[model samples]
Target chain A: MNWKEFFKNLKTEEQGCVPDETRREFLKIGLIITGVAAGGSLLNVVSVVAEGLATSEELSKEYPYKPHYSMVFRVDRCIDCERCVEACRQTNNVPEYGWRTKILERVDTKAVDQQRQFMPILCNHCNNPPCVRACPTQATYKDKQTGIVKMASYKCIGCKSCMSACPYDARYFNEEKRAIDKCDFCWESRLSKGMKNTACAEACPAGVRIFGDLSDPNSEVYKIVHQMGKAVWVLKPETGAKPNVFYTIG
Target chain B: MKRIIILASTLILGLSGFVLSEITEEGVKYQESEEAGGLEIIYTKPVKGVLFSHKLHVKELGLPCESCHTAIFEMEAFKSQRNPDFIMDSLYKGKYCGACHNGQTAFASNTKCATCHVGVKGLERLKKKAQVLEKK
Candidate 1:
């Protein structure tokens, strides 16, 4: 309607009607609801577009699809050489006492009481990572591209939140750096030219550690994971990290 | 009881529709990525009921797999964007449906709107056409 007509209508309206407080409240509520509905409709479109963009196969492909990289430690082959342990220290240049990676010895004496067997232990990089969610500073991030759980040593305030939160004791507080340091799957080394595998996998003389993409059907790691089946059980499966690292559970 | 049944049916129908749509969207991605020869495939589109012609186009165009299907949708039943609007854009940009439908390489986008967005023209007609073609 024209401004003149609108003004005339306004003037003609019942003047003494101070809409009751209840009515005013109702009107305010109604307006708020209307505003929210309008906003939601626009937001829905944006949300749909955003979701589409995020999941679009095109966008997912931009990050070159490397097979889901993972490591498997065969307990039987691991001689408890501490080679993998020492190699990780020397490679990463970890401090004298500080350890980025270490070997845990598990003794299974129920069946064979005297034969105390040993298995190397470290961070079983979980699939549905818990450490990632607990970090408030996002100091811990699982790489969407590589599926590697990475620790931001610089961003870390040495809160020790991750240390306590880790079920596996895989995380250690770097007293020197004043940050949490943990196994990165030797990402820096693997990413370097001509390095086809992680340091631990490469250093193992027995070829006990088989490393490859778990997703690739053709990959040796994938074949072993599927073929070994029930015999291959991961440590702390109850924790539900869906750890990429599987152990030979004999 | 009737109302409950109706609500339950509605929910079931909604879920089925969602799943069916998702399946179709992924299928489109897979078809688009197929290629042949050395000329890279730049795009692909799975027209409604048409058997996705990945290999056919590859041979016809003498194209490579990456050119048309730039995404990793090389596998069967590739996942499409969840949003219909973005799905529309992907088709337009030669990503999902656009991979093959853009005017330059394939049919123009407008020429094939009903392949996806069926308006008043009744999808039944398209369904009938697809059925008849299948019989042949």
Candidate 2:
């Protein structure tokens, strides 16, 4: 079927939230152009063409990273062991007062089965990272190669803007490193040396933390996120950060 | 005079209750058997408020004391954590709790973390219960 026909069907299917006349007309035209360029397939054309058109229209825009490094916390599995925290400290030489990663305990006496759960959190490495924008010196920037949010320690002036701007409370001032420090998925200490996973993920006795390339379909992170009916969600999604870090119960 | 004496006694009782609540014994001395039931181990090193329950392991699972004592863990409650190598890395390498919890013999240590890791909050809850029981 043609892109117009497919969109018309989709519009009908989504009767609950109908778009305005102008938006419908715009979508119809956009789809037609996308269909012609992509050699339209009736089966997967809608999603494929939609994404292709959006990205292609913005010539300056590009995929965040080839590997798109991400992490997922199976929150239900975290035991509050703090092994990941310990490993991150040892691996990165994180000082005693500050932490690059941490486990937040949630307790609800009213809940059935397990009332207590530990949530392991770190730098989300957001696609639209607020920390990157907040940095006056551009000290903290998202790495173009792997999409990992990295710190250029030398550039940091201890402004703490990135620290305050971060919704996840991930960044901290390090007297030792002489800059704002946060989890870079162990990029400098481990990935730079060709290690596959972060120290936290490696140290977790329970498979609580799954770190891998979100861009690679074969990676476990992709499978867990892309699975149908799985409730995968990111932290502070309302902030428009589009975090690479995801969380799920199962 | 009688009303003042009554008020003084009541004040003394309230003060004594407060003092008793504040008093807590430092360091749990390891013992083979006690009236309070099995041991409740709390590890302070590396991190705070990690708990291991002997009651669940022994009573619920029907595992004998020899299953862990003197082998995987020493007789002392917090002795294992005293060693610098007594971390989760050792567990992943099939040491300490990993020998049984390696996903084969038992639920893998990497799975169901809350099952054992009752964090600082859990540890405090257990300690409070112990104190109440001790008072009784």
Candidate 3:
């Protein structure tokens, strides 16, 4: 049968194939059903497309092909000097008991032979952040433009959910301020300085912390991680936080 | 009839996407056990020798994640060394093996053979299954 005739075979004359009153009733039902289906499909398509576009934009911001900069921490180079920690603490005026950044010491004193090794701990600024998930308010978010995991203190209801949920213990609650505080990657200062920079990284005497864009292959942080032959590691990876901070150990 | 075709195609596409993402997310991880227990030393004249340790470095050292590579390393295809010298140059310049044994951060570059090659005899035997892994 021809294509038109083949399609026409799907309907009976009484089932709206003809222009009679009964046919008109069938036609209306069929048209309404068909229209509803088409409209539903169109709406779904538009919503999915919009979601995909938003996701793409967000991914670009987080995992940019070339960001303005990023951060790298050389775990081996860290001396537990607390210079970076103190710098960040004082610069941001972090709470007395709560630290914005800290040094993680991996002491194997039980070994008896090897000297106690120390690993400084702080926010890894992960690529896939768990802290963002723990927050009920979506207060904790990662900025794609700067690649910084930011905490909206105003939106934060001082819930310690993020603090407890974060494996890195990077989140700290400012009891006095009655809000959550975490690393902002020195974003405000960097913007004012017209370049991406971190106060802790700048104050590091051992040059343990290097901050720049990892997306740009030529950038210092990227080169150090990719080409400079440094052994980079992230902390508490079992938590499944894909951190952006790279630590090179000798 | 048209609806059926659309639904079927959508289901197939969605399933394929999920499967592909799963594979991409959890790619192949090469972990060495005492099963491949022999030591292989690839050498360079006038430079130094490269010692491959199975039990000590990989199984021990207790290296954590992102310690050696970035996050995307888990999701990408492996590139081959186009030239022999390319691989050699990487070792010489400290890209992979040079990353640790450059004589500074990890082990010193010496003509000595036993530095990395000498495995804990008990560890090696246990890896060989001649002895069992001890629960220390």
- Would you list the C-alpha lDDT of every candidate in the order shown? 0.52, 0.69, 0.51
- Clashing residue pairs found in predicted model 2: A79-B113, A205-B110, A206-B110
Model 1 quality (TM-score): 0.46
Ranking by DockQ: 2, 3, 1
Q: Per-candidate DockQ versus the true complex? A: 0.01, 0.32, 0.02
Worst 10 residues of 2 chain B by lDDT: B22-31
Off by over 4 Å in 1: A1-65, A108-114, A192-194, A228-230, B1-136
Error of 2 at A148 (Å): 1.1
Taking the tens digit of each residue's C-alpha lDDT, what string does model 3 give over B1-136? 9999999999998886422111112121122343432222222221222224434543566554354445312322222222244243554576655566566767643322233222122123323332122221
Interface RMSD of 3: 13.9
TM-score of model 2 (CA atoms)? 0.61
Better of 2 and 3 by DockQ: 2
Ordered from best to worst TM-score, the candidate numbers read 2, 3, 1
- Candidate topping DockQ: 2
lDDT of 2 by residue, A113-140 (tens): 4456777778888887888998999999
